[model samples]
Target: MAGIPHYYLYGEPGAGVDRDLLHIEPVRDRSGPNDWRIRPHAHPDHMQVMLVADGGGTIRMEDRTLAVPSPGVLVIPAGIVHQIDFDPGTDGHVITAALPCLAAAGAQDPALGRAAGQAAAYPLDGSGVDVAAAIEAFRSLQREFLWAAPGRRAAIIAQFSRILVLILRLSLIHRAPAIGAADHDLLVRYRALVEAQFRSHHPPAHYAALLAVTPARLNAACKARAGRTASDILHDRLVVEAKRYLIYTESSVAQVAHLTGFEDPAYFNRFFTRRVGCAPGAFRRQAAES
Candidate 1:
């Protein structure tokens, strides 16, 4: 009960995954080492990486306290309530990526999120880069993000993906499912379009019009292969995106409400609350206050 964090979920997400990358922040919290006991936290759509830089600490994952030290990487799956804080004399750095994006890139294929368990937090390349180098790299990327460097954003994304590959190779013993070459080009095209427009327009019909597929046929293909309706997939993606924004961003509830395509703040409040069981402001406040 010493150093756990808190999390808040935003919606009842449907099956099928969405890829949205979020904030890459670095924590060098020596000051809060004594005062920073994060209560157990959970979010429905996020997995995180905790890289320690200094001071050793205890991480309570579900019902356990795994010892974490500098140059150590802790992988936490989304939807599990866990907490981490100073073990006694250690301060550390953590890098958190949205689960959807890591799920898309980390594996040799997609679907790793559902398959890969929490143990995926071990070394990157047999634990890549040793502890010291990885810490430097993580810090470098965090610094670049803070600077808001011009072309560095894309570079950081690439580096982050590469880091995930290393973690996957070491952590998951199973190979990923392959995407075969078949008559699914149109479906692939539709998926790409949906990824780009999910935050702006989540209506499956909007994507169906873009892909020149009748709504019925689109739904059939999606449900058959992905076991989800096209509209459900769209909402799942949008909800995941909204959660990412809320967690990693300092944006206000109203700003987040508008950015996620909600026209009325009241409507957004009702929408997310209906699914997640809490108001938007309450979610943000709880997330920040933690």
Candidate 2:
């Protein structure tokens, strides 16, 4: 397959957006020009959050497609391939922040990191007032971004953090009960370790050693929180990167295997096919065709 496009945003090339802190804009400003359809692309160091106030449509992230309705939130993490098709006349706000900025924020609140660590959609439920308040927060963010008033930068950061916290609250309400704090911390740290060292091909035992926990304990934490074994979590991370490389780069299957941490191309092919239901070459071809 040929290279899939990478962009900073919809029209903005990845290299052109130099701001490392944040960028806020309305959805229509970018999507309007493209007939409201954003093609599949990946951002190397930015994470995006979209709050849908009025209309909605489908979001394609990696291999999963999600339907988002009005009064919803979608967070796209760095390095994930994603596309969005908005309904005509859709109205909403989109914020693209440097992944480092998010990482800094997450340092203060690890839950925030988990919420934004992947592509997720949260459709707001409850009284109209709750939804209206979330929309107002988006408008407030936009105003501060435009006016650039005194202390505007701080205000923007604060408002953005508030929005994330609010969404976290809503997500928790609709999802399963929270896990134990100790277990949750271990799980979060495990995920962080996997993100940083997946390319190095470290085993789950290495991660457990780094986290000062036994392999059984790490597996238990992962199972309690994500319903997956620690080894499965590690393998899933590798598979995700494999799919990204296959879809976005012009690299050959052997090169992709090497890049994703497999020294032997044959083993990589078998691993990918077992987890992704197709060989790397076929996955690339399918992404190109779709």
> What are the clashing pairs of model 2?
none
Candidate 2 deviant stretches above 4 angstroms: 16-18, 127-129, 176-290
TM-score of 2: 0.60
User: Taking the tens digit of each residue's C-alpha lDDT, what string does model 1 give over 1-290?
Assistant: 12323332222232332225544544444226436566555543455666666566676755456666455566665545566676554555555556456645454545343333343334333343455566666676677656756776466666666556445554554232222222133444555577667778657887878878788888876654344578776777667666767877888777888999988878777878876668777766776795
Residue 255, candidate 1: Cα error in Å is 26
- Per-residue CA lDDT of model 2 for 258-288, tens digit only, reads 9998999999999999987888898899878
Minimal lDDT window, size 10, model 1: 174-183
Whole-model lDDT, candidate 2? 0.76
